[model samples]
Target: MTIDRPRSALMAVLLAALPAGCTPVATVGPSRPPLAVRGSTATVEIAPVLLAARDHFPDGAEVRNGGIPNLVGAAPVEGLGGGGAADVATHAETQALRYSVAHPDIRIILTVTEGLYRIVARRSAGIASVADLKGKRIAAIPTTSSGYFLARMLASQGLGLDDVEVVRVSPIETMAKELADRKVDAVAIWEPHADNALRALGTDAIELSGTSIYRERFNLNSTAAALADPARRARIVRFVRAVLAATAAIERDPRPAQALVAATGGFTADEVGRSWPHLAFPATLPGDLVDLLVDEEAWLAAQEKRPARERGELAKLIDSSVLEEALAPPR
Candidate 1:
């Protein structure tokens, strides 16, 4: 898929550990399929990648609406699939576990952005701190990163997920409304939905974030076959470089990027503005990505009732050379 450009909170995540990286462009080859890409149009996390595809891309790639699931067909279409048209895709690391094992060709080349999730609780629900979430109804999508974040957050407070009722929220766009209507007392999710919940609650809102526990690594992914081909690799590198440049533009002034996201994701300007700080456009591979994956595998493994993989196997899923070439010194 063609890439797109791609958060904030009360505690604010420490993404300084996620470094700024660069890359240069290459000309696309004349080929079949037009080199389409798949990613989530509804997610603000992928705005930069979307922008890159629209504004950059020498040969221009199709920015299909899907995610990592689109890159590989191992998982169901629930996540927005990559299929045959998806030469590239963007998704969080958790999704990688499900499809990466079955499809060994998949690899994460760059972390386009980071999702600093937060728990937006209704202060009226007798919750004002992370510790107060016990026995409360918390909305988080199960079998995904959001649920993992909920578990991690609760563990920090000496509580387990069993201590509270985990309410399932669908359409994800409804997460804010679910909490605001008191159907769920809290929501641990990605922005701008998390920020939407906070604003909905207003005086009743209590936001608790900032944890070393977990920050979703939303990355750019491609198959080994695509990268191994000279023509396709050249096109991929150019797309990656475009993504990095788009991120730089985002970090400088998010207004234009916000407008794009608001229009694409159907988010209001205030929602985009409020949630902007929650995201970090590192665009570089985070040093601890594999470590994060290893730590997270067990949770996903348990969810799917499968054995977790070793660190080495997970490491193979990330290929840094593309970003390195992109970040290489200009000759």
Candidate 2:
């Protein structure tokens, strides 16, 4: 995919402005076959990874590809797999667990990506904070991914969904068009989308600001369901190890990741590369962020569009032990 020039320059400036030595780029290497034993069973969101796994493990390995744009589709996939949905959306793990209550066998395995949140409004609009969004029509999707982030921003200024007119747009690219046409007054989107969207409007046309709101309140992740049989869980954990390894490879060298995501029709290398500076390439879950899921769960529960949920019940749904052990060196 073609890279956006103006946006690229802007990102360059912002990346430079970041605290010294905070480069988010990970050095990636050439793709190869699965390092772990083949024939493992696990579900993943990114289709490219599944395809790559097939290339890497062209043997008896069986991978269940079950990525949905929203958290809703992940539930059924998780149920069938005997685990809850491993959410691809930010802050979605807890919400997926709430879905697992009825389907007790399901659990969540998260593949976390790093990204930064930018609150954008038309340039010269002088909109410096979330408080300025009051009554403005903003474009975005409400997902487990962005739920907590947006809520925290709004709550930081005593605002809620009611404070602004939320225009439902599927992806950030689409939202960019609406914002460019003035159909929406503002938008909250992560990198790549934020970068791509800003390019459509011309860098000067949009004012950008970053906040801890997302890291402070939002969590983006992928999950695999938990299995009842300990042995099966063990297998799933092994799969998790492979997944983490792949993620690390991507983080180390995003070129492959950029290529993979582009091939999957998600975003381009330019977009991913631009987003790279703003995103985290961590190999582990943020416990603090995970702990904050309770608040996010509570907020989602209040929304009519969201599934019902119980307080503090989200913690039980996350089974990271497999991931923990998998990351440990082989005995």
Candidate 3:
């Protein structure tokens, strides 16, 4: 939770560089309950974008920030109800699928964004492509989406985790630092950290695009109890609507949204601007979400030596009714 000095200084500089009339800090609207919303500190997921678009939220809907290092364990999901958090956002679709499998009480209500993850390497490391990763030290945040990205990237070239030296890093900031310091040959990560690594290494950075191997889907997940409760469901619907509106706002004019992300994420405006094109802010759930989950589940089961889930069983993990209703014409 502690912001490092270098990051703190970068945030300060970025904030000061904003246009004269821009707000210095990201804000959220008032709340009815401490709506526990979990988001990662490194990715520009829906929750942070909503926080950045504070004015688009429903009146009196307060959002409590529950930013975490990553969404690998059940702790963040359990915190939605057990830890007094109402909603959580996950950067990886696989995590949401995993949560639904582990906790039958949780449902993936909405998918807010999608993007292409990348593997950044030093050009001098001879890692020009995924095929070059064998025996090389690759830094990644374990148990998060980055891990999945690494796996897929390797698998694309007939490789696996065993094909490379997996160097575990956390909180994302270290991933960038390690790659820049030459402590690792490559980093499999998501933005804005991936973007940060590229900037840090500059001419030395070589990005291995995973567009062919991986595409990320970030979702808003909630406990069954929250979905079952009328008041909480209504609030969640409103939250989704606000996120949809915020997505439209960003599409229309991204400067304010980028500024807010830079301020809150400890990223420079240039970094956000450079990374923006890779992200797609969509409010609705994808029609092929179940297929994607099934594919990921198969990949995971194979990798972990676990039982693969049936299509019918995996289909239950997604509940698009909320999204459908939210996007419906007002009665």
Candidate 4:
């Protein structure tokens, strides 16, 4: 699928914004060839960072975007078809907090590195927490990670699927319509979709708040594929740098950044502007969270979802050195 932002515009805006300090010409060291990195949305939140890195490095660090969801599992667009490089993929934040005992080959990257936010359809009145949804009808699809987040949200309330009715729906647009029609009480979604949900339901119909389980339920993780490959790891580190840099730029002056985000998809500058304060464009992977992910893999193993071979070796699954290097002070 085509990216939301056109190549010409993205290049122009990012290039024009390149500060003197960020200019490649300023670097005195001998230049190296740009790295070639390919993967799913494992490191997507850092897109702007990667773009800036490409400009400064000028060695052609190419990041090919495809189905980010597929990086954790099969591509979402592929439709229930599981059997690809990413079928084993998982969301970074969520996987980082859970146990995935049976998948040693599973690797997680700090892609979209932010916590989960519950964005309800506009009609829900004064709904501020998961507790408000005690007996409400929520809409979402189980196949997606967003659905998993919703599940975790409910779990925090001492409730499960049995507690409330779940409607099988995919797009947040559909969920918003249903909520508008009084079909569902609320909708749980991630970025871009969260923006869409807000617009469709309007403030009158929806609500937004942090989830009950902050660090444990909703967090980041990546694929084992990135850890095992040296070339991929180095490239990922560079990509992380790019994202952090872009985030700093975006936060410092949002007009162009919002423009970039909108050009990529359905989000509006107003929505992105409002949501900016809530996003955590972190480049470091905390150690305890890594431990949580190991436990999550173990949990998955106990549930018989993970492959048997990966059960006891979850600790070796993470390689945070790349994140550490990215967070290091620039020379």
Q: Which numbered prediction scores highest in TM-score against the true structure?
A: 1
Best by lDDT: 1
Whichever of 2 and 3 has more TM-score, that candidate is 3
Root-mean-square deviation of every model: 7.3, 9.6, 4.3, 6.5
Model 4, span 176-274: residue lDDT tens: 677767777777765545555666676565464645444322222445665557776665665566556666676577555454444333344565566
**Candidate 3 versus the native: TM-score?**
0.84
RMSD of 2: 9.6
Choose 2 or 4, whichever is better by TM-score.
2
Tell me the tens digit of each residue's lDDT in model 2 across 118-232.
7667764556567877778877666545555666777888999888877777634577787778888777765556666678778655544555555522222333432445654
Rank list by TM-score: 1, 3, 2, 4
Off by over 4 Å in 3: 1-31, 51-53, 65-83, 302-305
List the lowest-lDDT window of 10 residues for candidate 4: 79-88
lDDT of each: 0.78, 0.50, 0.69, 0.50
Q: Model 4: how far is 307 from its true place, Å?
A: 8.8
Error of 1 at 70 (Å): 1.7
TM-score head-to-head 1 vs 3, winner: 1
- Give per-residue CA lDDT, model 3, range 95-124, as digits (tens): 665555566566777777787789899988
- Give me the overall lDDT of model 2: 0.50
